[model samples]
Target: MTTTAPTATAHRSGRRFETARQVADAVLFEGYVLYPYRASAAKNRMRWQFGVLVPPAWAPAQGEHSLQRTEVLMEPRGAATLSLELRFLHAQRRTVQEAHADGTFTDTPALHLPDRVLVPWDEGTEERVELRVAVPELTEKEIVLPFNRPAREDTEPVLDDHGRTVGRLVRRTEEAEGVVRLHAEELEGPYRVLKLTAVVENTSPWTPDGPGTAREEALPRSLVAAHLLLGLTPGSFLSMTDPPEWARSAVAGCANLHTWPVLAGEDGRADVVLSSPIILEDHPAIAPESAGAMYDATEIDEILALRTAALTDEEKREARGTDPRAAAVVDLAETLPPEVLERLHGAVRSLRAGTGAAAAPQEPAPEALFTPDTPWWDPAGSAPAQPTPDRVLVDGTPVGPGSRVTLRPGLRRTDAQDLFLQGRTARVEEVLHDVDGGVHLAVTVEGDPGADIRREQGRFLYFQPDEVTATEEP
Candidate 1:
C-alpha cells in the first residue's frame, strides 16, 4: 500500500475533514507539558502520558504496548472510499551547547545570556501518514502500509548582539518505524454492514542500554500520542458507545484495543471518525471559548491562564526558556486583554425551561437586590431559585426539602466518595436545578453528628434524582 505525506491543501478540500482536524490537534498535545511550564517541574519530567506506542523490544519491560487497534462498523454505498490519517509525535532531544573562544562548543544544561536563558528539554514534532483505499479492496485482502521516518540532527546558532555565536541549540531525533494494517469483514444481516479493523504497530528496532533503562530512554524511539483519523465518502460509521438497537450485538463483538472510536465533525455527521486514546462521546467537539491548547486536557483554560499569569518573574523566565511552545503559553497568558480573559471565565452551552418539580420560579430584578455596580459573579446577581422549597420528581414521587430518601449512587458516579454513601438513608436538604436544567438533591446523611453543622454551613452531598428513592417520613 502506498502512503503519502499529509498536506494542508489536501485537508482543506473537505469541510468535514477540517472539523475533525481541529479535534485531532487538541488530542495530539493533550499532555505535551504541564502547568509551571518549566523543564525543572517534577510533573513535567514524566512527559508523554497519553497514547504512546513504544518499540516492541522494550514495551514488555515497561508494561506498555506497541500497538493500537480500532474496530468500527460502517455502512458503505456503491464503491465507497476510505481515507486514513495516522498522526503522532516524534520526541526530539534538544541540547544546549555554549560556544567556547577556541572554536569549540561544550554541552550545558542551561546557558544564560543577557536577555534570556536557554535550557535543554525534549520537544515533540508532529508526524502524519496518510493513505486512501477503496472499500472493496479492503474486503478482498488486508492491506499493510509500512512507514519510516529517518533520524536526523539540526543545529541553531544563538547569536549575541555583536553577531558572535554565544551558544547553539542542537536537536536530535531518533528514527521511527510503524505499520498500519486494514481489513474488513462483512457481517451477516439484512442490511449490508461491514466491520472495519485498523491496527497500528511500532516496529522500530531498539535495544536497552542496561536493565535499568527508563521510560524516557524508550520514548525517543516510540510513537507518542498515536491516533487515527478516518474519513469516508458515501459511508457512515456506527457509534460504539450508543449503537442502534439492531447493531448493538455487532458493536459489542468488535474488539478495540487501547483506542476509542468516536464520531467526529458535526454533531450528527458520521462521515468521519476519530480513534483516540482518551474516551469521548460521539461527535466530540472543542469548546469555542477555549483560548488555545494548554497541554492539560483535564484542566480549565481559565484556571490555567490565571495560574500562568500568576507565576513569578523568575518562574516565568524559566518557563520561557524551556521550549518554544511553553514560551508561547507564557506570552499568551500575560498579554491576554482583560476583555478576552473575561470571556474565558464561563460559558453556558444551552439553557431551557426546567421540567417537572425542578421548574424554577421567577425572581425579582437584580436592581432590587443589589446596586448597579454589583459584579457579574456575585451570588445575589444570579442566585438560583430558592432550593429549600423546591421539589424534584423521583420515580414520580415529589421529593422536597425535609423529605426522607435512600441514597443510591448512579452507576456512573463522578466522585469516589459516593461509594461510601451508597444505600445510606438521608434527609433532603434542598432540590436544586443547574444551568443545564438538570435536577440535583442536596441531602445530609441521617444520624450524622455533624448534620446540624453541615446544615448551618450549607454543605451537603448532592445526588441526581435518579440516584435516590423517596422514603416515607418516620
Candidate 2:
C-alpha cells in the first residue's frame, strides 16, 4: 500500500530506464506464397528504442520481461532477417496491495515511471500505424522484416451492412507502439544517429476507473518520457524456439503486443510525423499508407516548469474521490503550455484531421471504406473470413484463409501451406483474372521440401516479374 517511487535525490532513477534494442529487421520466406506487410514510412524504423513505462536500455528485474517486435517486409521487396530493437515495457497489472489498501479502484493500475513515453492519448493523436525499411549508408544493404508483428486486440468490429458482425476493426489501440525515425535524406555512408519515437495511446475513454485523475494525466506525461528511453511493440516471432528454419528468428524483446519503428526528433522540441496503414476486412489484402506530419513538441519545459515545477512528485500520490484519475488530468493541465492546451482544446478537430479521408464513418462500417472490390489484410480465403467473388488469398499456406497455419514449415501438413506458418515465400507464376475482373496468382513451388526452404526464404520473398521486371532479379 506504499508508493514504490525512487527518492527525490534519486529522481534520475525514478523511471529506472533500460535496454534500447537495436537490430536489423530482415525477413525470408520458404515456399512460393507471397509474404504480407505494409510498406511505407513506419517500416523503415530499424531502431525501435522506446517504451510506455521503461526508458531505453533499462534492465529487467531479474526476469525476462522486455518490449519487442517481430518483422517481415512482404511487398516491394523481400529480406532475410527481422532485426530490430527490444526493451521491456510494463506487463500485467501487479498486485500493489498498498495502492488498493482502501479499496478505491476496481483494479490497482501499475505506474509506468519511465523518464518519458509517447502518450499520444488525446483524441486523434493515435491516428496511424505504418512499416518501412531504410538501410543506413553504414550497411548499404537492403533490410527486410519477416515474421508477423503480432496484431493487437484493440479496434473492434462495427456493424456490417445489415448491422451484423461486419469486418473486424480496431480503433486507436492502446496496444500500438510503432517506429518513427528522424528520416535522413541522404542514402549511403556515415549514417545519421536516428531518434526513433514510438507512440502509445489509451483507446479506452478517460473514465473515473483505471488510471484515475492525477495518475491518469501523469501516464501520458510518462509516455512522453517513455518514448525517449524505449519503444514497446511486441515483435513477430518471439517464439521460444525459431519457427521451422523457414521463419526468420524474430527480433527479441516484448512478446505480447505487435509493432515497432524508427523514431526521431526530440531534444525536447522536435517535429513529429505519425503514420500507419489501413487494414481492411479481416483479410489483409491491401496496404495503403497514411501519414500526418506536424511541427509539435512539449512547450519549452521551462514554461510549464514555473507552474508545475512543484508537482513532479505526484506520480505516487494516492487516488482519492470517486474519480482519482481526474486529478492527474488536472495536474497535467496545470503544467501544460498553450500549444498542448490547444491540442487539448481542439482534440476533436485534430482527430478528424488525423484520420485520413478513408476513415469510415462511426456508424455502419462502409463496404466502400476500402476498395469495395479489394481483398483485406489477410487476403482471400483466410480464416475469420472468406474469399469473395473475384478475390483470393496467398499466404505461406496452401490457398486457404483463417487457418492457424504456421509458415515455419519443415514439417508435413495435409493443411495448405497458406494456412500455417508465420512467414512464407511464393512467386506469382501467372496472373489469373476471372471475367469479373478479380485478381489471382497461379503460383508454383517445389512440393514438401520446398515448403521448408520456402519458410526461411519467405521473409525475403518478393515478386520479381510484376510487369517490366516480371522476370528480373539482381
Highest-lDDT candidate: 1
Q: What is the TM-score of each candidate against the true structure?
A: 0.77, 0.18
Model 2 accuracy (lDDT, Cα): 0.25
Report model 1's TM-score to 2 decimal places. 0.77
lDDT of all predictions: 0.85, 0.25
- After superposition on all C-alphas, the RMSD of every candidate to the true structure, in Å, is 8.1, 24.1
In terms of TM-score, which candidate is strongest? 1
In candidate 1, what are the lDDT values of residues 305-386, reduced to their tens digit? Answer: 9999999988888888888888888889988889778878765432322232433544222112222344434455465765
Compared with the true structure, what per-residue lDDT tens digits does model 2 show for residues 1-474? 111112101122111111111111010000101101111113211112233332222213222112333222111112211112222222111122112335333322222222211111121121212233332321342222111122233433323246643223222223223232221122222321222222333222223323223332323222221222222122121122222232233213213232432221221111211111111111111111111111112233233333333434432132111112223433454555655443322111111211334455432222233332433343343356443432234332233211222133323334463344324434443444554655544333324456455555553222212211122222
Clashing pairs in 1: none
Q: Kindly report which residue stretches of model 2 are placed more than 4 angstroms away from their true locations once superposed.
A: 1-70, 74-217, 224-474
